[model samples]
Target: MPTGLRASDAPTLQRLCGSDQRLFLRIGQLLQAKLAFTEPALGEIVGNEALKKLALDKRMREVDATSFATLLAEHGGDGDLVLVDGEGEAGWRVIAVVDELGNPLLAPAPAEVGGAAILATLSPALRAPVEGLLHAGGDEQRAAALEQLRYAAPPLSVVSELMPMLLADGAELVRERAINLLVAAGAQIAVIDLVRALQRGDLAQLGRIADAVSNLA
Candidate 1:
């Protein structure tokens, strides 16, 4: 990844970090590699115990142990920094982004997020429930759907469809919430897919993607 998350991203990043400007700025550092990952970049997770255990057992890897920038500068992200889920970008689920050290910058998420391991294995039918909640469900149902978005981190087929409408939500809080979900969705999109999409787009669209991913000042 390059250093280029746009200024427009500021609002969403700030909101996602509970308006903690410092934490949001740190994320900026990680995204832009202002403090790129150092050697021995290891992975750690902040989900529930099960996810942690899975991280320890199934996901651990011994690497060159160096600064993040040097690693990427020399070798590139061989799935070391990004997370993937389901098939294609539509089903991608970003777990965590690492810091200047190769250590993953795990997020503080709901206990249910630990279930992401299992959820990612589900069939595409997961969208059916999300679709119902977005279209017909009442307040409680909508809230439930948001939880799914926040923790479960389902496929984009469902997530992509719900977001545009949510972004248009009239209430300020609702729109902010939608923006948060949109940010997560962006993470789900693979860089390769993003590049392909850009190939089909004009220069302006390409610039937007560049800004979205690596908008360094």
Candidate 2:
């Protein structure tokens, strides 16, 4: 999504830091503390404080070809707290708040999210196009839509409509996509449903086989 980090941006960023290692390290430490685990595998890392902190520093510094400032802009993001998706080739492999761009004007008052707040964050709008294809499109289109949903990382609730594809007569790829997304989201469903789907699928295959046999006869 983001282009290359400009070479000139480095000196500008360094000048802004003013060579204060203590302050810089402190900012880094704060970022380590604020890392949130939206992903499951990354969630496991977040559980370990010392391990996660170690990974956090490396992730922030892992610009590779890109500058740290650029990675910060691309993944660290544009907010008071720059949120970084750590699950790339390098870093802690978790989502982190790499740095705070500026202090908030108002006093810090964190509040619990309500139902509407939760819905807004999930962003139902992202699923609209995919849902359209899932409802009426062919297997290939359905599979592609599922891939899009997977990448988009919609909320667990978004998976409900897609889950039925697992038991659908065709579109094996769509079923795989739906299951993978559900597993990644960590939304548990009944094993019985999956078992039944497999059984039903097998039965359908058997029926087709029986029809072919009858034709041969």
User: Taking the tens digit of each residue's C-alpha lDDT, what string does model 2 give over 4-110?
Assistant: 11111222212332333332232233322332222222333334443344334555534332453454454433322223343332233223233221225322234
Q: After superposition, how far is residue 98 of candidate 2 from its true place, in Å?
A: 61
lDDT, model 1: 0.37
Candidate 1 lDDT over 111-163, as tens digits, reads 33312333444566564445444564455556556656556566555455454
Off by over 4 Å in 1: 1-125, 136-141, 186-217
The local distance difference test score of each candidate is: 0.37, 0.38
Number of the top TM-score candidate: 2
Q: Candidate 1, which ten residues in sequence have the lowest lDDT sum? A: 33-42
Model 2 scores a TM of 0.30
TM-score of 1: 0.27
